[model samples]
Target chain A: MTTTTATHRGFWYRHPNLRLAGLLSAPMAWLVVVYLGSLAALFITAFWQVDDFTGQIVRTFTLENFQLVFTTPAYLTTVARTLGIALLVTLLCLVIALPLSFFMARVASRRWQPLLIAMVLTPLWASYLVKVYAWRAMLQPESGVLAWLIGPLGLESPGYGFIGIVITLTYLWLPYMILPVYAGFTRLPGSMLDASSDLGAKGWRTFRSVIVPMIFPSVVAGSIFTFSLSLGDYITAQIVGGKLQMLGNVVQQTYVSNLPFAAAVSTIPVVIVLLYLAAVRRSGALENL
Target chain B: MSISRPTKLILTFLALLAFAFIYIPLIVILINSFSTNKSLTWPPSGFTTEWWGRAVDSEGVRDALLTSVIVASAATAVALILGILVSLVIARYRFFGRESISLLIVLPISLPGIVTGIALNNVFTSYLGGLTFLTLVVAHATFCIVVVYNNALARLRRLGGNVEEASADLGAGGWTTFRLVTFPLMKSAIIAGGLLAFGLSFDEIIVTTFTAGPGITTLPIWIYQNLFRPNQAPIVNVVAAALILVSIIPIYVAQRFSSDTNKGGGIL
Candidate 1:
């Protein structure tokens, strides 16, 4: 019986194409139909406009929504501010992540590495809103933990505003930056560092000339998360940003009432991220992600 | 690779500082959960378990928790099936557009959450009629696919096809080989992937915000709504504190499974 079953291959099993199709069809249909279709629909809707009186989306193709997004001073400022915030958050994460990741990857004993990585990763599983809320509590004007800590030092907490938003975002994304950079550090050969030192390079010189250049791809990979997350965050801004608004805030506010305009606003991040992805794809960072 | 003593000490101090930065707010959340102050002011005037008791009894909390569990389970189920299917093809066969398939899976997650959120929101409102429970599941599963895919793909690549071939050569049929060999080998990976996907879907807020219909409150949405209300702030803290404590289990379990394979670090 076993020999007969093994010798008699099913028709579907005899053909690799059929097998592949059987496995591939369901996932492909869902991804292409639901995900890609929606994205395409969103961008298409961006070119359309809304009627003034009926509060309805007009199907006619026009550049009015894009024009408003690009030409209006408020929208332009929001775009620039969002870009600036994303950049600042990325920079802050890189600064904090580098030494921390280096320590974990190189300096810590092998036994301690996994524990430290776990420490960094645990916060990621913590609820996002809860983390932001924690930051909100920490940044309360005169009576917050930060204020209390900095009070004796004569440095005031930056209250809830642009600075608060940057700090919170940096905190939220630091683990992402650390994990990739840590992986890069572990991948770096100790022989390379020894060779640099043996060639008479000082610590700073070796770090600048050898280390940073080698891990640049990892840095870029980490920056992708920091930049894009900050660019598209509204809740963080809502909780800690006080009066400041980013592109996501604009999108969220307008999406319900003026979807075409919101879709136009949404395109800003999409274009920026696509451009960023294209630029970094050459760096081989996409694979790291 | 030899570092000076001072430099090593400085690195250690900085690492400690970074850990503190990562953990301080969570510590604060824990403390505030017990604070008697209604507004959760720091340096609590007193300590009480009043909020914890209230949270245990809150109807809103119970309903939202149930909804979150259901949505996450449903999303994780869909993601596991889709992820396993895609990973099987990508790992077992070489094909055209393979890179594009990986890119398509990553795009849902790699893009900003708000972009994914608004894009799906637009489609649902205009074409699908309106956001509903199903829409929420679809949005979540779309992104959760990547988590499962990455874990499964890593395991499948490491596993290779030799075992399956050996099983077939021993007179097992195709389905029998898959069931006895491939399925058993990939079970741990699938569990790891499912746990991670569940955690992701459970905590998701941005996409949930856009995709969840009116009156369909998930845990994160519940936390968001009550976060600002004066009377609910303490209970919110209790819930958040409980979440931070409970989240450690799945993360630790997933870590154990992935580490057993020793293929990648922390499931990315």
Candidate 2:
């Protein structure tokens, strides 16, 4: 089991460095007690039965929670809506981030490229809550900036409820797309692009064929990040989607109000995420990186 | 084909428009914070810093802000430590469950925040005891750890094993080698990761909402409650604007550090 370090343990065996061990101890302990333990407890609580009407959980074990979650139309719809919105957001991020990332990588001067990346990265550093708050103010029905600008046109409310949430998520999480895309673009061999141009390939053609294939992994990485994040997020939907419930919201409500059922609903997204990850792993996409 | 000047200008304008789209609401709130009117009417009826004074004077806002600071600081520190350990182990050692461990550490980050929150809530409220400040810290740390670990592990990989070997060869123990060689190498990454963790924990609402019991409101929670206050709601604007103000300095610092690291072209 020790492999390379098995023989070396004798060196550290005599007097264990308390300072180094002390330094490492807290985080290791935290990982065990807080992270792994919490996950275990969460799993166990998910099996507990819940009382109807009052929305309290009982200690008794039952599959009723799972049954309720599977049978409920609202729960299914929320899951569908969550997945749909995440897909839309991922698509939107790709559409916007691709061209911009390409520009940063292929066109911009080396001196200017870092500055531009920093600019794109700024929104990511901003508080998530603040970004959501900003979006809320910008999308208010009457006095919103969009309403002010586009009121005269057919777009009376430019900020559609669920649509606004998707847009805001795209705006906030676009960096995830742009960063990987830019990295992929930067890693593109300068020789290949030159070869394409030398062969009389046009700019768009070169991008569509040569560039896209090379960066497909980055695209996958970015898409996975944005889609999963958007899918799992309940706040943006809760804050901006008005009264509409997404999977996140439903899971949240279940956690706070109905414990067992919420756990069951939560399992759907967890299984889906695990399945996706496994699929990605089986394809060796992550290993390729 | 060579790009024309007008096309360049148009592209620049479009980029600028994108920036504006993201920044306008933030700017509006900043501007509206000084409005004389109670309602958050766009462009403001007139200008006065009355709401700012009110926000500053309010006990609830102050307490919530303080609580947020305490929780964020505690959580970020915890996550930073955890991140260093996990990153070091993964980077330096070959363990049986290494790949799975890596996945587990990153899962909370890549998965939806709602899932993390709900999972944590179920654990804390059920098996664990009351939701105190420590609970919030633990919840925040769960996700925050990924950022630190990612940064640290990437740096560790880039540094390679030679330095540690050399230190040991020169009659240093493992701890000493780590201290003099590895720790110094990873300083900037740790700092960057810590700042990021702090920022994330500070503004995190989803997990905080689930883990925090009633009567212990964080700044985000408070802002959410006050968001639609029927009358005198501009105070919420003022608070939000103030939060933006508080965050800008650290956010800028974080961006600066992360970009510098990116440009340095070593690890990640």
| Residue A196, candidate 2: C-alpha displacement in angstroms | 1.0
The alpha-carbon lDDT assigned to residue B73 of candidate 1 equals 100
For model 1, the docking class works out as: medium
Query: Per-residue lDDT of A1-289 in model 2, one digit per residue for the tens?
Result: 3544644644464534543455456765776677777666667777887677766668887888777766888777777888888889999989887767766776667999868876766667667877787777677788776677677786765464788888888977887787777888898888888888889887678878888888887777777777777877777876778887778777776566676777777777777777777776644345422
Model-by-model DockQ, in order? 0.71, 0.46
Q: Name the weakest run of 10 consecutive residues (lDDT summed) in model 2 chain B.
A: B259-268
Clash count for each candidate, listed in order shown:
0, 1
lDDT of 1 at B184: 83
Residue B131 displacement (Å), model 1: 2.0
lDDT of 2 by residue, B194-226 (tens): 887887888888888878876889888888787
Question: What docking grade applies to model 2?
Answer: acceptable
lDDT of 2: 0.75
Residue runs of model 2 more than 4 Å from their true location after superposition: A1-10, A13-29, A53-62, A282-289, B1-14, B255-260, B263-268
Residue A79 lDDT in candidate 2: 75
- Top candidate, metric TM-score: 1
The DockQ assigned to candidate 2 is 0.46
